[model samples]
Target: MNPTARQYDTVIVGGGPAGLTAALALTRYRHRTLVVESPEPPRNAASRGVHGLIGLEGATPDELRARAWEELGRYGLAERLDGRVEEITPLAEGGFDVATDHEDTIWARDVILATGVTDQYPDGVEGFAACWGRTVIHCPFCVGEENADRSWAWVADDPDHLGMTATAFRAWTGDAIAIAPPWLPGADELRRSLRERGSDLVLGEITRLHHTDGDLRAVELADGTVLERQTLLWPQPQRQVPLVERLAQDHALALNDGYVTVDEGRQTSIPGLYAAGDLTGKPWEQGVVPAVTAGSAAADAIHFATLT
Candidate 1:
């Protein structure tokens, strides 16, 4: 631990929606909090705007973050540091020593792992990367309203997830198609559900995407079949940030699948270590509202724990 390290009641590892919300909650409770964020582009950097947020609908990720910081500025108990957290060392005396890439060390009595996850898209899909967050989306509810009634396709890696998403997507668009990878398990029940919902199921290896200026035109199959589509919902697999992964490995924090497992209070398996947002395992529950709720809940838990 550095002798000159700054100390706070809690240190937030990520500055995304969850981190910012937790910071705000802690500051409101008069608890000293520090938010550490990297200079790299956020996961939602390419997203045009956030949806399902009550009042800030259609606001870009930058705009949302700016507004959060603006609100945080009103509270003097919260501080922001721009740097990537390299490692976290649990102090024997109780607390944590957080090391950053900038060589700054921070000490905190409690830590909130809101580092979130990174979306992993399918490889070798031309134009897919460019259209991500616009024409190529993940959640149907998030982008459903804007792209409603448009030709839509649900490209999924798993058969179960594909069937579920395809069924739900019908609420937004009637012309929903489920494009399954060749390795996806053949489930007769899933196929029946899709057909009942008037959704088409196509099994093929996706070769590439045809698009113009981030707007999707069609999905090209390996067999030279092109399915015209204006919007695509791909619930891409998400991986935890490196910081969270290190903590999971070192501290033996519980995890469900790839996401960090947390109790109802957002408390991780490790004492004094809490987590929120996308890092917590909840694929169907990914959105700004749930992230904010998790952050707020985690902060409340921390506040109560400190009192005890």
Candidate 2:
């Protein structure tokens, strides 16, 4: 190691549930770990509370993150750096050189990319962005109960995902209104299923979403008609983060259906590199347990590999 080198047994590229959990596990193993939390807010930043995560139910995103960081603080082997990663370079000997936007560079024997994913919002919908994570949510499991019992709009970018999202939202609301084009694949069957469940379907694109800060009011249709609603559930398409793109800038980063492909151990195609959390699969499938499991698994894998 260089005389002034900042080195770690492993460097984690996110501070959300996954990265934090991984850091906790690695530090508990007495390994030096550094967790880099991006300056950007988390995916559910606007949601008032987090659900489906036992013991931490109803905790807001800010609260959950704060608690996670505080817990990691109890372990002295972990360090937290708040900055955006700009570049990552593989070393000739081994390990990685990670550069951040803060003009800081660090080294690690291994890297875990819990970097997460970014949602691609619809372009022309009015107030959709503003209402997202507030009145408009991704999963019913995220903020279901409080936003339940009333009519809610469910938007699906792909028809294949329509049935799954529609069924999930039905647990909270009886009258499920799915905002999708009628021509998409599997539309008729999904529509039939909705009707069978005493729910309704809205076939077409969303023109606008009307909502307050934490309450939805209505949804406007392309035909100049509006439906009263208090919540809008959307499972939009998600893309990988910029760090993944930068890693693939010169060469192809192996992706399976636009997600970073990892083995059972959570290591990516590249050796000494790994990815967990929503970056490895559907972003909406994220919660505390899954994040913790994936993160801890990666930490254990790195530890066992190091032992040999």
Taking every candidate in turn, the Cα RMSD to the unseen true structure, in Å, is 2.0, 2.5
TM-score on alpha carbons, each prediction? 0.93, 0.90
Q: How many clashes show up per model? A: 0, 0
Model 1, total clashes: 0
What's the residue-level lDDT of 83 in candidate 1?
Answer: 88
Query: What residue pairs are clashing in model 2?
Result: none
Candidate 2 C-alpha error for residue 118, in Å: 0.7
| Model 1: colliding residue pairs | none
- Candidates in order have lDDT scores of 0.86, 0.80
Task: Determine which window of 10 residues in candidate 2 has minimal summed lDDT.
Answer: 157-166
**After TM-score superposition, what is the CA distance of residue 227 in candidate 1 from its true location, in Å?**
1.0
lDDT value, residue 296 of candidate 2 = 87
In candidate 2, which residue ranges exceed 4 Å CA deviation?
Answer: 1-4, 157-170, 182-197
Off by over 4 Å in 1: 1-3, 157-167, 183-197
Best by lDDT: 1
